[model samples]
Target: MMRANENARGRLSWKVAHRAIPFALLLLAAAALFHFSVEVGEGDTLAWDQAFLLSLRHADDVALPLGPAWITTAMVNFTSLGGVTVLLFITLTTIGLLLISRRPVEALFLCVALVGGWLSSNTLKLWAARPRPDVVTHLVAVGDASFPSGHAMVSAATYLALAIVACRFLRAPAQKAYVFVIAGSLIGTIGLSRIYLGVHYPTDVLFGWCAGSLWTFGSWLLFRRFLPSQA
Candidate 1:
């Protein structure tokens, strides 16, 4: 019987180890992405940033993108996806859905995460104190230190937080997939829009994506540990 129990314990340990592999791999990926992005941000004048930013605009008119007039207008609309008003709206809508689903705890945590993300991103912006891109004219009015695009950071945090909740709580896997796809599109488009409009360099958007994703995943990991079912 003692020998049998030992065998059972060994099997249990192996199962636990297997369960941890995916989590470990995810953390490793996040770390790699974040590290390279921070390095890029530190040296803003690096080749890729300037080349990518300048390539988007017309050779004759720095203010205009290479595309037609309608494309520019469309980009302007897409940029709003990362705007304060839209993020707030998305947050409020998600909070209501969570509440209605009878997951008050999840709803509360979502609220806190978004507010914290907003404050943290803004603080980082002030800390970096990097000026907006001067390679071309800005299509939209902006007056802030622009190391990391605020829209990119804020949208990533808000949308990813919502995606996490949906993935965990929703029954169907398709629902989870849909949520992530929508969130990802918004985040990607907004970040690119900042560069296209000349309000932020590519480095700013990349840094924002890295930081915002790291914060979202870190917070979700903590919450999952403390309240696994709720998270």
Candidate 2:
């Protein structure tokens, strides 16, 4: 029965690979981010970070970004979407909705994920203590360390966590995909706006995105059982 055994082994391998692919990718991404974070912490990326930050500004004047006036204004507006006031309002409104709908468990999960994510973001900034890019003028005011962008991290955690919870109530695959796409687009735009505005280095936003995503995903896994099932 050698042939039969080989067929069974192939089927087992296929099943294992199918189940392992996503986890493998996630693990690799996390490892890469960690390595990059270390490099950043050791000041090994300073040269490239400064070069990249300056590339977005005109060589003649760092204050003038590499775009028209209207684009600068638009970036400012987009940046606010990830600001404290907007995120706070959204978080409160979401919690209210969940409570009213008798989904206390889901509400609690959102609270833990978002609140914990915020604290983690702040902690990372303090730990890294990476200064904001001095190679270019910051279009907006910023007073915190810039290793991990607070706006990017918080926005990714908030939007992605919300999207995950929202997708639970969606019955169709298209609807779920739409929710995810919107969330991802918002996160990407917010992160890019920070860089364009000269308030953060690209690496700061990149690390923020990675850390925020991992935190939210970890929170989801921890609370997935308590979250509502799909419609």
Q: Who wins the TM-score comparison?
A: 2
For all predicted structures, in order, the TM-scores are 0.83, 0.87
- The digit string of per-residue lDDT tens for model 2 on 170-216 reads 88899999999999999999999999999998899989888888888
Encode model 1's per-residue lDDT on 30-139: one tens digit a residue. 78865765675577356677777779988887777888889789989999888989889988998999888877766876776678778878987877787787878899
> CA lDDT, every prediction?
0.80, 0.87
Residue 24 in candidate 2, Cα distance off native in Å: 8.1
Instruction: Please report, as a residue range, the 10-residue window in candidate 1 with the lowest summed lDDT.
Output: 222-231
Cand. 1 TM to true fold: 0.83
* Model 1 stretches astray by more than 4 angstroms: 4-34, 41-45, 226-231
